[model samples]
Each structure stands twice: as structure tokens, then as C-alpha cells.
Target: MVRAEILAVAVVAMFAGPGGAQSMDKATDCGYQAEVVAAVQQARKDRVGERQVQQHVAEKATWPENYNNAIPLIAGWLYGSDVSMRDIRNEDFAAAWKELCLQQ
Candidate 1:
């Protein structure tokens, strides 16, 4: 799963055309948010994992600590809040990502 996610991100970065870091960040954040939301929706359907993401317009925020990629953010949220995906917010992503790291 991680490998696939990384590949997807890389492919997107490759064909996404050159842009300022801000544009790249916006794209990355959007992609990351989508993945996280999918996990939440999946968990809701599958009845597994925590659901802590709150559905809302997440205020722009930096990536979580000890991680520089979008994958970790989604992974962490899925692992931390199993069977309980809520609306995702940038503020809560770090804690979720931490859980994913520690648990895995």
C-alpha cells in the first residue's frame, strides 16, 4: 500500500508540470486529503479502524513532524482512528500519523 501510494505521488509530481512550491504544496495537500477521506469512508463501510477525521475545509497547515510526505499523514490517520473516520482536519493529522508510525 505504501509503495503504491509513493508511486502515485511520484507519478503525479513527474507529470504535474513545474510549479512553485506553493502550487506543489496545494496539489500534494489535496491529494493527501483525498486519500485520507477515502480511508475514512472505507472504514465506515468496512467497520474497521478509527474514524477521527472531521469533514471540513482544513485550514492550510504544514505536514506532520518526523514525516515529509503525504502518505504518512493518511497512514497515520487510518491506523490511529480505526473504524471511526470523521471529518479530516490538518490539526488532527499529526496525531493520527503518529499512531500509524508507532503501531506499525
Candidate 2:
């Protein structure tokens, strides 16, 4: 019974109105955003650790290869749009920005 209730709650949370997280401005942009997020989320769920996620994000956002440096750019916009989008801090944002944008 407890497990069923938990499953129900998870379903409700998953299907909740789109008002909670920052909605992507453009629908087309959501595809890549979802892809990057899924990668990070999967890494976290696999217990690869936050450092692993950071490294993966870094490698994924490298220039002239994947998305031409769109991952962290999208992440920054998402961060600005929704404070609760992720637990990432300003320092993380800065590092990502520098690595993906400035150093690219």
C-alpha cells in the first residue's frame, strides 16, 4: 500500500502542470535541452557522482562538435528562468560558462 501511494505521487509529480519548471522559450530548443538533462540525470541516478556529471557536461559542451556549444548556453538560460530548475550553484554556472563559451 505504501509503495502504491508513492508510485501515485510520482505519477502526479511527473504529470503536474508545466508551471513548475522553466518552460523552454522555443519548443524546438527543448529537444536538445531534454537530451542534455537526461544525460546528467542518468549519470546522477547511476551514482556516478556530481563530479562525473560536471565532467560529462564539460565534454558534452565542447565546441565545434556537439550542438556547437549549446548545452551550457541553454543551461544558463534555464537557470535564469527557474531558480529550482537544478541545485547547481553560481560557481558551477560560471565554470560551465567559461569552459563552454570563453575557452571554446
Candidate 3:
């Protein structure tokens, strides 16, 4: 998945308008972004269906409610054919996501 897709939800919330300033702290937002990714990744590993991933995340997420909005997008990317869930079973996507988020 593209970086934009991974960051979309958090980015949208961080910014105000076309050229408006950021409304939230980047570090905290990125951390929440990583949480969303981690939650979705775990749900997928648990065999949660794409259609059910949203609900699964909503029920279990410990992050801010706003961050949960990213669940659908993250789930779609994780469940997409291009990404093999089995192949990523051992990967720490949450850490990778946080690293990328902070770098941006």
C-alpha cells in the first residue's frame, strides 16, 4: 500500500484546510496512526473478515476514537491481495508504521 493510504486518516485530522496549519501534534498523531495499523494487522491475523474488521477494531481498540476511523482503510490495505497476511505474520508493521509516520 502507498504511504498516503497509510497516513491518510491521521493526516486528514492533523490538517485544517488547503494551506491551514496542523491542528494536532505530529508525534502523538503518528503514534495513534501506528496503533490503528497494529489493530488492523492483528485483526487480520486473527482471520477477521474485511467486512467485519471495522466492527472488530471498534470493539477492541484502545486508541482515541478518531483514530478508529482509519480502521477501514488500514483493513482494506492489509486484507488486499497485494499484501499477504501470512507472509507478514512475523513482521512488526506497527513499529514500521510509526517509524514511517515520524519520518514524514
Q: What residue pairs clash in candidate 2, if any at all? A: none
Q: What ranges in model 3 sit over 4 Å off? A: 1-23
Candidates ranked by TM-score: 3, 2, 1
lDDT by residue (tens digit), candidate 1, 26-45:
44544444444454444444
Best prediction by lDDT: 3
Q: CA lDDT of 93 in candidate 2?
A: 34
Model 3: lowest-lDDT 10 consecutive positions: 12-21
Whole-structure CA lDDT of model 1: 0.39
Task: Give the CA lDDT, 0 to 100, for residue 69 in model 2.
Answer: 38
Per-residue CA lDDT of candidate 2, range 1-104, in tens?
23323332332334234642235333323334345544444444455544345566656552223332334433333333343334443224333322232211
The per-residue C-alpha lDDT of model 2 at residue 67 equals 38
Candidate 2 colliding pairs, count: 0
Segments in model 2 whose C-alpha atoms lie over 4 Å from true places: 1-25, 57-104
